[model samples]
Every structure is written in C-alpha cells, then in structure tokens.
Target: MGENELAEQFGVTRAGIRAALIDLEAQGLVERIRNRGSRVRVVTVEEAVAITECRMVLEGLCAAKAAVAASDEQLAELTALGRAMTKAVADGEPVTYSDLNRELHARIREFSGRRTAVELLERLNAQLVRHRFQLALRPGRPQRSLKEHLAVIETIEARDPQAAETAVRAHLGSVIEALRG
Candidate 1:
C-alpha cells in the first residue's frame, strides 16, 4: 500500500498509515520497498522450509512440556479438538481441518507454559499462513496430518514427554518435506 493512498482511503493521517505499515513490516506480514511502497510479504518455499525447521524444535519442546504440564482439563479439550479435526478430514473439509490445525498448535503451545517459545512461534507462524494453507489443501495432506496430529494428542494425553516430543518432531518434519515439495 502506498502510504498516502492508504491514509486517504482510511481517513487516517499519513503518519498513522506509516506507523501501521511499520508494525506490519516488523511482524513479517508486509515488505516495504523504497519507491515501490509496500505489499504483502511473499515467503519463498526455501524460506518457509527454513522456518518450519525452526518450528520443529520449538513445537517439539512445547509438546513435551505440554505432556508434562497440561492439566486434565486441557488434555480433555485437546482430545475433543482431535476428534473434531478427524471429523473434518473424514468429511473432506480441508478448510475446517486447516483451521483446526492452527488451533491445535496454538493450544499445544499455550498448554506448554513456555511463554518465550509461544511468543516466538506465534511470530513465525504468522509468516507461514499462506504456505500452510497451500500445504493443507494438497490432495491427501489433511488425512496424513490428522494421523500425525492424533499421534501428538495421544502422546500428550498419555503423559509421555519423550513420545510427545518425537511425535511433534516427526509431524513438523513432514511439514518441512511438504513445504519443500
């Protein structure tokens, strides 16, 4: 968005538009080119794969911690989510499955109680929205990921930290492979 055009369209001052764009840029949602103004940032496949590599470690840690730290209530909710996700996939609803996929990861992070990792994962995930959506819509992707996600939930529910971490790592490793493709 051009600063002046956005300001005029939104009835905000130029400074306000500039400030908004600055925040978006900091969040990796927008790219500001000197004279070309700004546009939604495009994350290349290579970059997406690299980001998923980082996510593998953080998410695996979160899964392990969530296995050890999550209460019974949290575990029950995760189980419910897993059931809903399975239904979504069986019903051939990729969009619903994709939304549930995001929720599953976010909830796992929340239950982990690792604030720093959660915050960083949130930032990294925000940048991967387009790529994730694309991957989720691939022919049999949701079905495959459902098994992976259920493995995660099962390990967490069983309170097996090592298994939970391994499940998460394997899930993200699959994601990285998809992104690479």
Candidate 2:
C-alpha cells in the first residue's frame, strides 16, 4: 500500500514501485484507487464461479485437442503424472497432489498446441491460486478430484476427444459447484 515504503525496502525508486503496481493491477492481483493507494485485490466467490465457468469451456477444448495432438512422448508423460498424483493422494499428501494437479493441467494445455487458450488459462489460474489451494486442503477434496482428473487422462490416452472434453467439463463443473459453496 505504501509505495515509498516498498521502494525503501527494495532499494528501488518510487517510479519502479508504481510500475510494478500497475502490472499487478492489470493482472487483477491488485486494486488501485484514485487517491487511496493500492491494495491486494480480493476475488469474490461469484467471480470465482464465473472464472471457473470460463475455465470449464477453455480447458475442455484444450483437453479435447490434447487428445488428438499430443505426441506419444506427451502421452507417456501424462500417464506418469497420473500415477504420481495417485501416489500423492494415497500417501495422504493433498498439497503434493495439488501441485501435481497443476502440472497435469499445464502439460495438457501445452500438448493441446493451442497457445492462446493456454495463455488465457494461465491468466485465469493466477486468479484462482488461493481458492484452489484452500480447496485442495479441504478434507476429501483431493480424493474426489483425483478420479475426475484420472478420467481425463484415461480418455485422452484412449484418444477419445469427445470423452476427453466431457471428462474435463465434469472435473471443472465440480470445481464450479465447490466454489459456489
């Protein structure tokens, strides 16, 4: 909130701090008022649901495309990641599973070969970190989502684009429901 304080702590100029704030504001990570300075932006529950709704569509497209476009090597990596996620859940490490969940989604996006969708997903995901993390730590949440995610990987490995897209929508639809709670 204090640009001068930030500048002094980082030994940077006020202009530099202001510029950084500008970028964060553009990213929806901060809110700047005309004269009240800047503060961390809080994403409301409704906004989270809206964001997840958007993700359900875009990520479904990515999953479907990845099913068709992913190379053999990419398939192998995704399979391995699924196994790792299973192990993480079985070992009672939701945090680790959550991290692997991110990796799995990222790989799918990359394999889809849709640069624009991947970029937009990245921006949207940046806004969901807190909600996603909290959900990951919720009791039984990881276990439930694990099967959904595995279904996505399984369908993609089966080279079924329609099924892959359905699986992705199902997964994110559950996310939307949870966010609404």
Candidate 3:
C-alpha cells in the first residue's frame, strides 16, 4: 500500500509510515519502487537460511550470556514461560505457541545484559518473523520447538553457558533445516 493509505489505515502520519518503511527497507523485508511504491520483499529460501544462521549465532550468545547473568527471578520467569509454551502446544494453539516462543527468546535476550546484541537480534528477528511464524505452523513443529525451548531453559537454569549456547544453536539449526524443507 501507498504511504498515505498505510498512514490512514494505521492512524499514523505519512511521515510515520515513511519512517517505518525506511526501517523495513533497511532490513530487506521491504523495498521502495519509485512509482510502484513500497512492497514486501520476497524472501528466498537461501536468504531465509542466511537469516536463520545469523540468528543461531546471535541467539546462542544471548543464551550463553543469560546463563551467566540472569537472576534467580529471571530464571523462574523463563521456566514459567516454558511451561506456558508447553500448555499452548498441548492445547494445539500454534498462534499462542508462536507468541510465547518469541516472548521466551526476548526474555532471554533481556536477561543477557548485552544491550547491543539484544538490539541487533531484535531487528533480525523482526525481519524473520513472517518466515518463523510460517514454520511454526508446520505439523508437529510447535511441539518439537517447545521441547527444544525447555531444554535451553534447563541449561540456562543450570548456569552452564556452553551448554546453553549449544542448546540454542541446535534449536536454531533445526529451525533452519525445517525452513529449508
């Protein structure tokens, strides 16, 4: 949609839409085409894999740092979130599971105490949200993901940074493979 239309639909100013579009364009999720205006960029499988690979490393770092830096309260929160995700999966609510999944990761990043890495990972995550959500819809994927998430949380709770990193990388690598399939 045009900036004016988007602004009207979102109840924001034209400048707001323009700014948001600029950010999206920078993230390679959208592009401005002169007369054609801005459009959602089609992500190829290769591009998706690249994004997933980047996420694997960044998130692994986040998990590792979180293992070392997270307070007992933060660890409890993660455990609760993981339980909630398990419930969501058992209820067969993919949408809820996906939302909880994102929240769990964000919580880990927040607890990591690394502002720069968290910021970069958040931006990369925004770009990957669409693909990630689609992947979450695949049969049995949500259950598998919940199991992986719980395993990561277990490692974090154990205060094993290396194990936490390995768990996160393995989870993200599985996500990349699923996306490829």
Top-lDDT structure, candidate number: 1
Local distance difference test values of all predictions, in order: 0.95, 0.95, 0.92
Error of 1 at 75 (Å): 0.4
TM-score of each: 0.96, 0.95, 0.92
For 38-94, candidate 2 gives per-residue lDDT tens digits of 998889989999999999999999999999999999999999999999999999999
lDDT of 3 at 138: 96
Candidate 3, superposed: residue stretches over 4 Å from native: 7-16
Root-mean-square deviation of Cα positions for candidate 3 versus the true structure, in angstroms: 1.7
Off by over 4 Å in 1: none
What would the TM-score be for candidate 3 when compared with the true structure?
A: 0.92
On the 0 to 100 scale, the lDDT of residue 61 in model 3 is: 94
lDDT of 2: 0.95
Candidate 1 lowest-lDDT run of ten: 1-10
Higher-ranked by lDDT: 1 or 3: 1
Tell me the lDDT of candidate 1: 0.95
Mind giving the per-residue lDDT tens digits that candidate 1 earns over 149-179?
A: 9999999999999999999999999998888
